[model samples]
Target: MNRSEFLQRYHHLRQIDYEADYPLRKTGRAAGVLIPLIDHPDGLTVLLTERAHHLRHHPGQISFPGGGAEPQDNTLADTALREAEEEVGLLRSEVDVIGALPEYRTISGYAMTPVIGFVKPGPVLTIDRNEVADAFEVPLAFLMDRRNHFAHFIERKQQRYPVYFMPWQNRLIWGATAAILRNLSSHLCDD
Candidate 1:
């Protein structure tokens, strides 16, 4: 959707479902991710990054720029902005923090807070090779469309858990990132 329509439709302050339909740990370390929505002429696009293949966890996965909370961070929002700047060279000043979704606890022991931000897609991002290998943007319209989402099941310890996947062109946006987008869709999509 366009900027005006988005702003008018999405009431960030309203109550929303904090957690997606997934088994979550009771406790996990606080983490934050910025769901950067860049304002394009036609519609908004979401900024995503492919994790470095060498990373210890979730290698080569598509994700938002964020990480575990540091002591220096004043809030989860701060953590999101800090990680975004560090991972993608997105300046803090460029992002306008709109709102946040409730925390989604991952199986990997993270209480990931999804911070939604509005940005203009002009800055040349410097991808940190250590954390991210590539950065790309997917149109928000494509992502928010429920038709584009697929359900995949993973068997762990004889239990089947549903994972969401949104394949966009050559990239497969799945796992937590896709789940997060699904969560966002619940908020942004009209009933």
Candidate 2:
């Protein structure tokens, strides 16, 4: 979909009341922003970050620009905006938040809120060397395509759980990130 179409559809997504329970031993909350950048002709692209391998959680995984909520954040939206700025150097003024999807609970024990935002093309991104290792964008059309999504199973300890996995280029998008993307894809593609 194009920029205007994506934004219009996203703005109309039915708000799902969902919550995720992370497996982290400690209780905490995290907020992430799904920044969708739409470039003309090429179509819409979703910005993703590869976290530094040295990080404690989900190291090197493809994710949105976000992190644990801070005390200074007055609301979840603020938390998402702040984390995005810290990780990707995107300014708050540049993003036009459309709405929020349902909350996702990670097996690692984080109740994450995925904030959806529309960004204009061409913002110089400066990645935080310590937090984000690399920044990239994936075609929104590719992600929204149901044919690209596959059901994968993984064994953690002795229990087996089915999860969604999407592979684009050499990057593997799976786990919680893929789950949220799957949810978004379903909403956008619903006729």
Candidate 3:
């Protein structure tokens, strides 16, 4: 979708009192993610990052730029934007925050709030090697397509929990990241 249509459709969902299907999870701390959307020549795309392999939690996983909330952050949006800048050098001024989506509780013990925003793509990103392995964008059209969302699961301690996966280019976008994308799809796209 174009910028205007995207905003219109996205705003339509915001009018209702709604959240994603994820109920409160038992694990993890409070966190927020900046889901950056850029209107590219190809189409609208979402910025995503691959976590540094050395990290103790979710190593090498594809994710949004965010982390556990800190006292310095006045709001979840602040946390999201701060983390985005810290991780990927995404300047706060460049982001036009559209709004936030529902809160999703992660099994790793995080109450994640996704802040959606718009940005301009170029040679503007400076990836922090410590927190991020790489930064990339996947077309929103590809992600919004229901066909691209896959059903998967991991066997943890003999328990099976559903996981979502979206393979874009060579990266496997899955787990919490994919779940957030799925939520956005349900809210902003018909398919």
Q: In each prediction, how many residue pairs overlap at the backbone (N, C-alpha, C within less than 3 A)?
A: 0, 8, 5
> Which portions of model 1 miss their true places by more than 4 Å?
12-26, 157-159
> Candidate 3: TM-score?
0.89
Candidate 2 wrongly placed segments (more than 4 Å): 13-30, 39-41, 155-160
lDDT of 3 by residue, 81-150 (tens): 9999999999999999989888888777688999999897673989999999999888888998989989
lDDT: the better of candidates 2 and 3: 3
**TM-score of every candidate relative to the true structure:** 0.92, 0.86, 0.89
TM-score-based ranking: 1, 3, 2
Q: Is candidate 1 or candidate 2 better by TM-score?
A: 1
- Top candidate when judged by lDDT against the true structure: 1
Query: Which order, best to worst by lDDT?
Result: 1, 3, 2
Name the lDDT value of residue 97 in candidate 3.
94
Residues 2-98, candidate 1: write the lDDT tens digits.
Answer: 8888877677556666335445546788999999999999899999999999999999999999999999999999999999999999999999998
Cα lDDT, all candidates:
0.89, 0.78, 0.84
